[model samples]
Target: MATDHQGPATMLDVAAHAGVSRATVSRVFTAPESVAAATLERVLKAVEDLSYSPNAAARSLRSGRSNTVALLVGDISQPFHSQLAKSVAHVAEDRGYSLLLCDLDHSMDRLQRLLTVLPLQGVDGIMLATGDAIETPGIRAAIDAAEAKGTRVLLGSAQPDSSMALTVSPPFEEIGYLATKHLLAQERWPVALLSGFKGSVVSTLLRAGYLRACLEAGHSEKETMVLDAGFNSTSAQRETAKLLDGAAMPRGIVAANIPIALGAISALADRSLSVPDMVALVACEEVQLAEQLRPGLTTAGTDIGVQGEAMALALIDAIEGQAATARALVPHLTVRESSALS
Candidate 1:
């Protein structure tokens, strides 16, 4: 629906138009104080266009009882992680809570610096979306200390000590298995798997999933190769170019992220080989470019926003002294022309 053309829009209506959760709309109107400044701006604009106003007084009263949740992200450029953050923002908004985003410098040491934010009274909880840094005991302990001081702590992905904090994420392994299987089903053999950064929890989980699919399909180890592409377009491109220079080309490929998938496509183009005709491809995360490609990319996608909202709610529940701890989201496959057989 168009932004400005709505009749007596409801909170849910505002969220639908904004591509966020209904609770987010409520948070915008009722708990503007608790909502993230960025989310507040977006929701306010949506409210104006929809010609709807929230019960500001009632919301304000509710906002008094709630505080904002903070989410720390190491890489906002990664499509999958960015999608998850978008979802978290909506969920936080819906619950009449604001979100604080801390863009880290991608160093474990920086996490220590971010810990200083936890002591602030306005920070109700802290969510760690840090990639490999979750493995660092210092980081984990610092987050735990925040929790000990009455701020709830949650994790978007796995950590070295999961029991120390609540964890929520999609079935990552299933996502990888599904993507790899899709490529294999296209009758493409010797499928190459472009795994993400070395030692990344997501990379390990996804690589295992891809291996499961290949082995189940009777493909041998030599038939598939795994590379540590480091989860960026430039790194992926460089790594894939080296693979392209090898003796034999892969007939199919499973990319663990959008950058790797795009890198693979670019490398193939440099060699004058056509996608899907010479090599079928699948991406683990769905992004707009997937649909915009010359022969659109097939991807394994999940309702990350919904999952993020759920995690937020779970954190809220945990803060309220309830027993909710963990939840897993399942991914759905989206088929497009890129992985289709000629």
Candidate 2:
């Protein structure tokens, strides 16, 4: 085995060492299927002996492709967003691309700037979960600017009515409907919705579905209770505690997400209230530990992994000059002890 002590071994070094032309070495990497078996084996052995690796930057420059994708998300610490990032990265790797994940920290200003900057950095595609920032003019303009630079874009989760890129979104309203309806089926009345921030498109859609279920159950709008719980467990816990302190607590609760459901459960336990015995609980979104709680958390939502895979593939298609279409995933309910009548 020969070690290149002068910086690092180049393709020329590997070509000379392997007794093959530099073109053959390039073909071995770029189109290994086109190379003969013995030649491929010889090149691979030489590459291993010389510790040779392709220069991504040089190849990208030659091919006019960076072989990189960026995923811009709001709060990657959240389980849902983190799951999305993992799923996208897995698919990107399988498709011969690398993923660059960025968190906006729920800041519109940061999102606006990144939307413009990532494309300029030569990312072949971008998948963004813009949250409520999608409504802003600056974000939209930034998205437009990114597209102008030949970077394909994909929008996920909370999208605007008219999307600026290919979108793969879950059926938020259906998730809420199914969660509330499950509680209602359990013979629980006066179900309340513990939703995310008030102005988010996700919250609004969930509220709409909650109200629809209440109405379908012959309950008036006045009978439905909706609480604003921010996007995390802390806010949800605080809000749930306040609700417990108030007069007239609903018999059932539909939480907008897994974090909200966990918070509500914590609040109930702190007050010595038993789940499904005194009050029933359900979450409109799914998480990995949904079934591991004291009483398993029931959820009604699309699989986050599937959603992420779809988003990445759509963006890659758009990047490769193919027309990409928007996708709307339907939600499915998973019943568990939290929402059970017995």
Question: What's every prediction's RMSD, in angstroms?
Answer: 13.2, 12.4
lDDT of 1 by residue, 191-271 (tens): 888988876888888888998999999988767789888878788888888888888778888888788888888988888
- Tell me the whole-model lDDT of each prediction, alpha carbons only: 0.73, 0.81
Looking at model 2, residue 216 earns an lDDT score of: 94
Best by TM-score: 2
Alpha carbon deviation, residue 58, candidate 2 (Å): 6.0
| Global local distance difference test of model 2 | 0.81
- Kindly give the stretch of ten consecutive residues in candidate 1 with the minimal lDDT sum: 56-65
How much does candidate 1 score in TM-score? 0.76
Error of 2 at 306 (Å): 0.7
